[model samples]
Target chain A: MIILTAAPHMAVWGKWLGDALGTNAAGAPAGNAVFGIFLSLLVYLIGQWLFKVGKGFFLFQPLFVGMVLGIFILFLMAKVFGTTTAEFYKSAYKPGGDIIFWFLNPATIAFAIPLYRRNDIVKRFWLEITLSLIIGLVVSLFFIYGAARLLGLNDIGIASMLPQAATTAIAMPIAAATGGNAAITAMACILNAVIIYALGGWLVKFFRLNNDPIGAGLGLGTAGHTVGSAKALQLGSIQESMASIAVVIISIVVDIVVPPFAAFMGLK
Target chain B: MASQDKVPQTETTEEKPSPIIVQMAIFAAVLFVSSLISPLFPPSFPVPTPVIGLIILYFLLASHIVKLRNVEKFGDFMISLIAFLFVPSGIQLAASLDILKAQGIQIVSVVLIATIVMLVVVAYTTAGMIWIRKHVFHRSVDVKS
Candidate 1:
């Protein structure tokens, strides 16, 4: 009910705001990218504010909430202003959004700091950690491939599903290389994160893994990616550190391993 | 090292980078080099440059070529908001609505189930390894001693 009422109002206000700022909602494509990014951040901030005041309404994770807000507003704008969704996304959203996406690799590289801080612990169990991530990596691949096949999805779906467990930095390229839609891979990655963010702690507790932060971190990072890592941070520094290492190792290993194996199996 | 108290207590003094320019320059150089080499592999078997960039940074730290204090703050700033970098991609899911509406539920379920199983499996494997190390390995060492 709220979304129904609020979306249209928000759309109208957003158009008005854009006009007041002298950027037409329907304008040349050149500046729309910058406006799109600004709009995304603005909507995200609003989502954050709403989450805080709503006491984490619906267990709202900020990124997911922000994505929903962006989608809703963009959809509403398209409907109200008579623009196609394709054009709006391409001209208005992708350019600005792509700038932020480019930074993702750097942000991932920055994880080296945490891994460095936890170097001693990592070294002590490097062998075990590596072994566990390899195992987790293999299992993740098989699970997705097997499940998608069982569900009767075609090659593109199977390819996208295979790398769903890894972060987007790794998943996107792999998906494209293996004949999957990169967008589907991104969607799968986000959905995977949402699953982990929502249920990760409970799963940790249920399995009595909370007592072992390394394992807990491995599990979270293996399946959850960034959102899982976020949950791990709440568990403790060990879990957070282990998760950071796991996320990095899992991505590197999957990148090296998935493609050749896919070809051998004749997977799309 | 996982425990905050276990790390040697450093007096809470802020250490500024002696030359922030050099530090930033090194990061940029590493990133550039990694990106250059990443595409050398076949497209079907591409390596992500960021992973290579991370390895270079890690080696730099491990070899004491760069002090943690020099790049630590910048690294922390980037990583802490790493998820923010992903928001745009998540929003881009809007572009694939037809595919999503068709397979969204199935995809979500697949993600949920696989993730849950993977989480359980990883947790138990780590915990079991810890147990074996503590009980079996330590017991054998004690017996030998």
Candidate 2:
């Protein structure tokens, strides 16, 4: 929640960045996806050149720069040419965006691949994953509700806010069910990534970690999605796999959990 | 270099698969079949057909029912399609301009707070489990040892 605690300034910047990128895109013929990929490659190359490093930091990535470039590309597409193919890019992307239901079928099945790869991991810790998901989801909502009360954002706002801790694909459904705007969920996704990057080091120190890698990965993935997965991957291959698994599992879990919890609260 | 190449000409050669196109066709055929049968998984199952197709494909891959290298091209095609599925959905924010403007700040603030809270708590809980493992669980093991 450190991000929320320090949000006003970031929102200002996020909106401004989104607007500026959108404005810049108004004139380009390059579609957002192609542009996003090239721009991301350019940033990584720039990061490499700036550090005079070879393949190192390209590997040393949390992918925030690349994701920002994705957002920036979208902003440009939307602001600059919201009229043409720009509109199609938003909905046609398969799993997470417009054709979202496309993901539901596949994500659950993709779980089977991980299940195949980590049969032993699943056998040992499937229960742990389940238990942690429930406990984490509950604690997350409780804290969010409590914070909303403290901030005077009202019960409906608190209920809408509760799902924000999950991935955008997962959170948006819950928010839409509870009357929250999906755009905010997208903004929240980017903002959450930024906040975690900025404060992740401090949180690790505050927790006085004894090099507990899975804990780090799960924590990061449950909240941060690919950004955190990339971070965990940088920590080590084992951590990366676990974090990736956690991101998928946790998002799916939230997809099932958060909306029902809101329903129980009678938020809608 | 010509002499080096000739040494292999005298050696036994390994048989290779016909072509990537053949493998891809096989893979796509598998996907098409699985998608057709996925609904047969019954009401108890929650996942849809295409992913079920992937699972069946993965098994065929992992169990040596199919060679990994053979399916690489087809697998890459499907996975790439899976990843970018969100670009189009993100643009809906623009389409819903009036709706968003009406609730923008409220939605942003609620989501912002929830996102941060979720991260910190999940982090803390994870850290807590490790702490318990080290102190309570590991200490008991240490005493037994």
Candidate 3:
């Protein structure tokens, strides 16, 4: 009888340990902060591996894959715990997720390194770069506004799409400030990047940009952001440098341009 | 090739980058100063602290106050993790699934068309400027090798 009682006590202790470590008695993930971080890191690594194994297929891109997988796992965890996905994300995932998100600011500051390294090209073509970026920025705003409205999206949707040309780091806050949804802005930015990465070479060929490294780089950086810059790096050193410059210049311009443009478009 | 030839010999002659700790310290210092300075801008027209940090680092590098080798390694490392850093934000889409499910196709189509249009327009505009610079102004710009 003593042994039988002790078995139940030991089982209780095991359940406690499992909960603390973000696993349940059944070995499924429980709602725990550390587990959230571990899940994100593991999922991202899986994404990287898949990208490699898939032979650089665009769908296998780490960020996209990690996101999809992470969300799916979170949904599964929520179901296992008998709670909603949003509640799980808030209680279990957010603490660790926010910690990882905090690094984005510092990572963004690192962009200056590339910009500084490539300052020579920027100095030479400042005029062309500025003119092209300004034109692109204006045109992008109008295009996004027109398209979003034509698609019957509301003001919030239009606001979110307004900053789509900027890098995710720069775009998200601008979207929030302009009454757009940051989450939606992030999706738009990622979608923009994936599309550009997949189609950048073909676009170059279609636009007859074979000899226009500067043009190609600027477009890639302006429209595609970091991923576009990555594509630019594969093209050539000059293109890489130019793309870096475009990323910075376009970001600053968007910061200045989006507020007034949004107001003019009647978006709060 | 012209650009490659123009790279200073001193750059190649420099020793390996500074230690990782030192590189990280430099970034930390720059970021700390940026955070302090960023709030001076009004909230209405917010300039991201990182952008301020970027400018500060640029000037520091341009003036040689901060050696490129000091920050290059760590900066590259941080940049390599950028895609990973963005994963959490992407996961936040789980919260907004309703919007996505309702208009997923529309959103995708809009982004697809807008991105392609932007790419073509920006590329052509830039190429047009380069052409005008070389032909119309007769500028003796060194053609990209």
Each candidate's lDDT (Cα)? 0.74, 0.53, 0.80
lDDT of 2 at B24: 56
Error at A111, model 1, angstroms: 0.9
- Measured on C-alpha atoms, candidate 1 has an lDDT of 0.74
TM-score of chain A of each: 0.83, 0.60, 0.87
List, residue by residue over B30-141, the lDDT tens digit for candidate 1. Answer: 7999999888988778777887888888888999888888787677777777767777888887788777778877777777677887788778777777678778776221
Kindly list the per-residue Cα lDDT of model 3 for residues B41-92, writing each as its tens digit.
7766777777788888888998999988999998998898999998888888
- Residue B71, model 3: lDDT of 91
Q: Please tell me how candidate 1 rates in CAPRI terms.
A: acceptable
Segments of candidate 1 deviating more than 4 angstroms: A1-30, B1-15, B18-22, B131-145
Query: Using lDDT as the measure, which candidate wins?
Result: 3
Per-residue CA lDDT of candidate 2, range B98-144, in tens? 54456556655655566556656665666566467568766321211
True contacts kept of 1: 0.69
Q: Which lDDT value does model 2 have at A64?
A: 35
Predicted complex 3: DockQ:
0.54
Instruction: Find the candidate with the highest TM-score and give its number.
Output: 3
